[model samples]
Target: MKTIVKRSSVFFLICLILLMPISSFAHGMILKLEEPGVLKVEYDGGGFSPRTEITIYDEEGNELGKGPVDEEGKFHFDPGMKVHSAIADDGMGHRAEYKEGVEEKNIPKVPVVIGVFAVIAVIFVLFNKKAKARQQ
Candidate 1:
């Protein structure tokens, strides 16, 4: 009975884990204001976002510039002080918005990856009590 419970739990947990990235990819891309003019695009999961489109708008809701992010997921242009908002889109459903009053955090890649791994580790330990008891 315990084995069956463990197996079912593991199966469900794995399914949930696999689905996380797929769902996130559609809505997890974020645009960071890297010193006002420099815009950085990246997945919420971490690393470069391929072929993201970027648009910058002024305070009056006029587009100052619009273009594709580079292969490195970066776009650079100085729209001067009148900047109001920016949008990043991957054209595959992932979109992120940066507005004047609402600031999006530019989460560092290494730390975010580490945090995710840590969560997975915690979940593993929860399911496998024996694993935690075993110490090298």
Candidate 2:
């Protein structure tokens, strides 16, 4: 009986580890900003649905702009100049931060988005690992 319980516990732990990753990603939070000068950000509050706040920052880590998300989960930043970071906070209790100006290139958006996606993907992967372990 003892061995059975131990084996069952270990199995449950492994299963939780696997499923936890998908659960952590169950809620999707998206941020979008078209131009560096405009700094417009859009958010989608996963399925839970909630209000969100967005913030913009410069290379020096100074806050450039901030505001609450709109009804459709959107926020705009019109600093009229380039910035470094764009952060969002769901009023329901979730926050998301984005970093810009990492690359020293002035190329078209195709390359820029590829670079940005790579960075975001790395962040998500690391975060997912920790979140999954915690959920288990």
Candidate 3:
């Protein structure tokens, strides 16, 4: 009885290990903007989906440009001038998308920069403080 149980357990363990890799290959797609206008698409199973097709669309859902992903899985276009969002399809049921709404850059940055400096100053003062006993 003990030998039979041991053999069954070993077989189950081997099967589990063999099936785990299949799940890795079934991973979904991922899309990211490497920069303002450069888009990157990746398959979680692989490093990048090379030769995948990319479509750039404006806010109105009209196509602006269509192309294939390069070896680095990157596509380049002028987003600020015409494009709004993009989609990458591997033609094998793997699809990734970027759908950020475009808007004007009217916000000021000086105030935000000043606030960050203030935070750094406060942290520096706090950390540089000498112990009360040491001062005495």
Candidate 4:
């Protein structure tokens, strides 16, 4: 009886572990501006449906450009005019959008540079100490 219960418990634990990865997947999409006049779109969840469409528009509701997402669930386009916003639709109910001039917090470069130099200095000091210990 003990052996049978232990075996069943192990089997249940293994099944739970295997199914955890499937639950981690989330269904969503995202649109971002790569640069001035350039936009990128990406889809999450599973593979993109065929002919996933992306469209850019101006503030006045004028169409800027439209295209289809590739097999890798990504698309990029350059809108000739100033863009106000953009939208992506997989035609199977998944959709996402990006509004123009969304302000991303600017991270100052000086702190990042200083942190890198500090790490390098620590590594150099450790190596130098190790070499000296070896010589003695």
Per-candidate Cα lDDT values, in order, are: 0.74, 0.58, 0.70, 0.66
lDDT of 4: 0.66
lDDT string, candidate 4, 1-136, tens digits: 5565556556655664574444233456666777775555665533556567888888998997888866665565654677888888878777778888685443444586577557656865665566556556
Tens-place lDDT per residue, model 2, 1-136, is: 5565556556655764565434333344556555544433343434323356678777898888777766555565564756678777666555566677343222354575567557656865665566556556
Top model number, TM-score:
1
lDDT of 3 at 116: 56
Which sections of candidate 4 miss by over 4 Å? 1-26, 44-50, 71-74, 103-136
TM-score comparison, 1 vs 4, better candidate: 1
Q: What is the Cα-based TM-score of model 2?
A: 0.47
Query: Which of the numbered candidates is closest to the native, going by highest lDDT?
Result: 1
Model 3, position 79, has a per-residue lDDT of 56
* Residue pairs clashing, model 3: none
Residue pairs whose backbone atoms clash in candidate 4: none
Question: lDDT of candidate 1?
Answer: 0.74
Cα misplacement distance, residue 1 of candidate 4 (Å): 31
Report backbone clashes per prediction.
0, 1, 0, 0
Q: lDDT value for candidate 2?
A: 0.58
Clashing pairs in 1: none
